[model samples]
Target: MRYTLFFFLLLLSACLQAQYKINLQINAPKDSIAYLRGVVFDDKNYFPKDTIRIKKNVVILQSKKPIVGGMYYVQLDKSKQRFYFILENNDNLSLEIRGGEIHSNNPRNQVYFQYQKLAKSFEVIDSLYDAEVGRGRKFSYSDKAAFFKVKTAALAAFRKKALPKLNPSEVLHIYFSALNRLDASVPDKKNYAARLAFLKGLDFNTNKLLFIPTYKELVSEYMGYYPTQADSLLKGVDQILSRVNCQSKSYPYVLNYFVQLMRNRNVQNNTEGFVKFVNTYVEKSSCNALSATVKKTLIDDAARLNKVVNLAKSPAISLPDTTGVTQDLHQFAASFDYTLLAFYAPTCDHCQKEVPEMDSTMKLIESRLNLSLGRFYVCNEPGVPQATWRKFISDYKITTNAKHVELPSVSDIRTQYDAFSNPVFFLLNRAGEIVARRISPNTLRKYFAEIQRQRMAQNP
Candidate 1:
């Protein structure tokens, strides 16, 4: 019995020692809460993960539970003083702050410290250039050229000196290498290839690159680059995916980022691209990086998009009016040259603002084109109380002539229409074909005004 008790104590000791532990010394007063934060792609955002109070000298943070490997920051509670570190499960770390420099026994932190120094130095020079421009200081062509040359040389020197210090086998080395930024003013950047080429070469086998600002900057550059039309954007997303390993965290991040990016865009085939991206890259992928719930949710969203997406025939919808009588959408649309369908939730802030504008725009359309408000149809999404819908209608002062319809609870509204991001609009021609989608109130006014002017010129 004594031997068994001794063995249990030994096991407990081993279990306790196998935890992720860190001894950190920061420049703060006694009992201050030091927050352990996960660094997001934006270096400015340090999302707090855990916190512990600081002892007089060192704060030893430990958890028997595993912590995922990621770049993180240590911040004093409500203070600007912070430091960054790359951490992994069960990593033994010892660090101290002295004379504003971090002293660490961990070799990885040592390399990251070098990287941070070089990065900060580059940023200082970059910010000076930005401030010069922001101040509206004008530079001659030759002067600007000289500044570019100097800036490029400075970056090159920083990289060259820091290159030998990084071990090639280390994952931190790969992350550091991705931190190099090229001047957007360079002529090569006019081509999409130049913007994405740097990120394409990174070692995505390690997801450490995902947490760094450099990778995200290049990603934003590539995504936000000019000619951001549907095909170009889709191709840009594909290029990023081709370079990243499907098994890595980068796969889902890139897939979901671009999918959501293109979802709201009014460009032609943007919805198609959104669907194809999620289906082909993610649904077909064998990697477990993306959660099943997220994958299913995105897939279901893509399906909903297909229902009312631009250029598709408007699906058959029969909804009840505020008077407890049902109306057929196709039959109502037949009486008009065009039907404007608006789906909105009563509580949606954007819907509340837009619905009023829509009513005023309809009045303008009546005055300008001699069209009646009967052509406009405003729909309240299913599942909300009728009182909320009535309140929205009353608050917005919606026109009586227009059809104010409500999709009943336990209806096909979810399957037949997209009320996902409420206040979505679609312009349908008399043939029940979707002519334009997400048509705003202002846009509707402008379009009919253009048509009215063209018709007047034709008659004149």
Candidate 2:
């Protein structure tokens, strides 16, 4: 009898330490497919790990082993919409979806649902506030302002009280969500200085919160307000970086996010800010985890960017013109006040439409502005039939006024200009410096015309 009791106790402990089990049920039309996707940190896209088929409006998904603590989502294959949920090691949870909403027995999920609801309601109120300003009314929130004040205070109090009881994942979510509430509130009428100070005060140097995607968004939105003020913008970024310990995960996360943000926004006009950031944090960072490849890539990108931005002369291009005569871009047409270099491919659909419009616009503008135009057709010589290139020129009637060039080496051209897309243009002044780049031909024309007008006004 004693041996049997001991055996039973051992079996109970084994069961208690078993792998996580998840039971998910969906009440939908018959024969629906649900994809269970694994979550990636700071990425909105999900990759399916498993798929379950619904029969009689019921489908269950489970894990044979413990999953790493993070977020996961259930997506309907038919609708392609996803709903999020939290997962932790050895979590035995059940979720039910009905009437386009999810119900879960887990406390973490309950808190997430509550936050979502509150955020949705706050968005509605914020939209009304924006609508009033859209109609040209003074930016007065009136009753909404009072409501936001009370709501924000209550959220802060609730978060402070409830955060300790929640897990790290849930705490980060609720903390960021609560902080987001302050963004919608109306600022003081006489001064908005307090808002900037509040934004600067938020700490993002923790490693655990680094996994949350919203943290990057918060940093971006806060720093984006001072685009022209490079000093102010870098100051704001420096505040966040100051808290980041170089030895921690937050170092790479913050640095990489900063680089990607500048790249995406094309901060050429504010290159000083980019330069300052790289110098202060990137160069000075001696973190052991900072890999050599990443450092080299970052330095290389900054070098490439600096060369082509404003004062840097355009890279030299030596390719055969449409007539099979080789000519360098520097000597092709050196007399004009500005040269428009257009890079394109024959097979690109957007290029097909955009190239013609650009050709026509440049011709029209050249009749008035002192501008030169060159079209570089990027294609392999023998591989891409010469007939295709000739036909493109004939269709666009480009040869009547503009100089045409055919480039066989596509890789070198892409690297020199950092041309990621087709139909890229660069405007060079008479001195051969790149005065304007990555802008529409029409915008460049307007800018040139305005500059000429300003000059004439000064002379008159």
Candidate 3:
């Protein structure tokens, strides 16, 4: 009797060791369409209720309770079909496929065949698209007509089947691909225009996938080739901007693009229109803070241009001097035919190299013409210990001719000037208006010459 009891205990231990135990529970609405739970074994699907024995790397899932050994599959009521899988103990495993067949469990031969077919299709379609777009035809159908035909058919197939179901990211890919196809060599304006019109009509608000790239493309095209289409482009942009509700995330990119377009394009003929558009949009925009800042920037920029236009008639200056001492910019302006306001940092390498060059130029121009140079240190390392500030000043020998002063409000100065980088130079006339600004050492000489010419013309 003692031997038989011992044998029974050993048998129980062996049975428990062979079984892969799993616990499952359902915590979803009863009206769910479908629910399933399974474990992955060597990338194969294993239902918890199945009788087939699973090997290593096996996952076990169930619909109701714990399942002991072999894999098993469970189907809850079609309605309220949600289910979850749980591991009972520390089992080396991963879970997948709550509702469908595990693709990896397909026989290795079938997997190989599917992959080969996919690769061939991808290669053919990719080649056709590239050839069609790359053909140096003035018109779409002029060169590589055969390739274009193939590409069109393939694209249509993709759009009809995939576009409706595509997520935002996928839609963006399609839009970008279409844009890439619109090249300078393509003579087919009608086709390109139609494509763009279609993209413009896409529901960017509900599907954010194609919004940014589409906006960018429209901006580029407007600036590059379609100045005549400004009204239409602006309308499209207004619609897009309305949908971008997240200011902190989206405003910078959109604003930067607008600023670039305004700066690069000669939109003066449409200045009134542009200004009205900005004012109306700014008033309606959710980007109140950004809008205010941009408006100020635009106003200041316009004011500067007005000063330049009135350079000969009204030359006046009111900028602050070093030591926070207010000086009539006109004082330095009239004394020197050309004045350079050097914004620099003592520790900046570019400043170190630039200051001496500026000093040499000042010396060269001083005798032949009335020229003055004043340096502003733009103390970037503000609030440092006094000793550190003094040491930095001394190390750079900044006192030679330049005046040193801490910015009255460093934050304000940075924001006002947009001074993210160091060693900036601004050229001013007798009117204290900025004639030019330079960041590169190479460009400084050219700007200086231009300023000198302008001054001579004014004085002559």
lDDT of each: 0.66, 0.63, 0.44
- Candidate 3 local distance difference test against the native: 0.44
Greater lDDT among 2 and 3 belongs to: 2
State each candidate's clash count: 0, 0, 13
Estimate, for each residue in 1-460, the C-alpha lDDT of model 3 and write its tens digit.
6457545644654556633333222232332223344432211333333332222222243223333212123344543322222222223223333333222222321232333344446577667666755783333235544455555554445444544543334423344344444332233334556435544543323322223234455434433333323353465456556655543343555555665444322232233334444555543454564656777776665444333334332233234434456555445555555565555565667667766566556656654455555544445544545566566666656554354545443454444344445655555666656555433333445455566798889999
In model 1, the runs with Cα more than 4 Å from the true position are 1-21, 26-32, 40-50, 62-70, 76-83, 86-179, 182-200, 226-230, 265-268, 286-312, 318-328, 331-339, 353-402, 437-460
lDDT of 1 by residue, 198-276 (tens): 4555554456666655556666556655443456677777777777787776666666667666775444446666777
lDDT of 2 by residue, 146-228 (tens): 64675666556656665777754553454445355444534443334754654654556544345445556566655544442
On TM-score, who's better, 1 or 2?
2
For candidate 2, the TM-score is 0.64
- Give the best candidate by lDDT: 1
- Among the numbered candidates, top TM-score falls to 2
Ranking of all predicted structures according to TM-score, beginning with the best and ending with the worst: 2, 1, 3
TM-score of each: 0.63, 0.64, 0.35
Alpha-carbon shift of residue 427 in model 1 (angstroms):
2.7
Q: Rank the candidates by lDDT, best first.
A: 1, 2, 3
